[model samples]
Target chain A: MRMDRLRELREAKGLSREGLARVAGVSAKTIEAHEYGRTSDVSVSIAYRIAAALELPLDDLFSASLKAVTLKEAV
Target chain B: MRMDRLRELREAKGLSREGLARVAGVSAKTIEAHEYGRTSDVSVSIAYRIAAALELPLDDLFSASLKAVTLKEAV
Candidate 1:
């Protein structure tokens, strides 16, 4: 649910929150909620949209490598 | 929102739907709904959980290459 990298990436591109949200086809609130970790209900589809809009790989936006590893072990 | 790869990967791993759901920490219905495209509310987090459970990369599970490319151009 963390998106520090996303914030950095978006800012580096000189895009406002709403600017990216508009182009990504998601609500501004969705982008704000994700960047601020306001909720844990982030959808995979939206994340992919954001990543695509940013022209980066999806894995690059999350800081959850440890979590992915843990979940992998759980399976 | 397609997950044909997911169904195939799970079956190849010799896991029943419920079995994989148990291991992935998601409900069987979540797996079922996603597999059938019953809804488009697929969350990014759940998809990652499923992918982690399958021991496969997330990008491999989707058939939306064209969409991703489109979004990239939009931003």
Candidate 2:
């Protein structure tokens, strides 16, 4: 349910809450809810799409390890 | 939305569908729905809980690679 790393990563990428939501095909409120820990009910597809939008592996969303686990490497 | 890897991994662990659901803290129907692609709206916490039940990294749920990413290493 915690997503501090996601907020930091999104900020590091210079993406706005709205920007990430748009590209990830989620509502801006969805981004806000996850980032602020307002909800723990995120969908798997949305989480995966956000990771894909950030060009990082899905683990990147939940982990702080800088090691890049690309989708290719993951699959 | 595809989670064939989850079904394969579950079976490889020699766990019954109901067993995994109980261990993963999900409904048996949730396991069936996901394994059979009958639904695409899996919750993030449920997904993570299932991965924890399997003792596998979250990425393993969505990917075919056999590399084991442990929770310690993931953190």
Give the per-residue lDDT of model 1 (tens digit) for A17-64. Answer: 999998788889888887787866565667778887787877777777
Model 2, residue pairs in steric clash: none
Task: Report interface Cα RMSD per prediction.
Answer: 3.1, 11.8
Report the lDDT of model 2 for residue A35. Answer: 82
What C-alpha lDDT does candidate 1 achieve relative to the native structure? 0.74
Query: How well is each residue in A1-75 modelled by candidate 2, as lDDT tens digits?
Result: 344478988998999998987777778888898788887455666777787678787767775332222211222
lDDT of 2 by residue, B1-75 (tens): 545488899999999998998787778888888788887556666777777778887767875332222111222
DockQ of each model vs. true complex: 0.47, 0.22
Docking class of 2: incorrect
* Candidate models: Cα lDDT each: 0.74, 0.69
True contacts kept of 2: 0.44
- Model 2 chain A is weakest, by summed lDDT over 10 consecutive residues, at A66-75
In CAPRI terms, model 1 is classed as acceptable
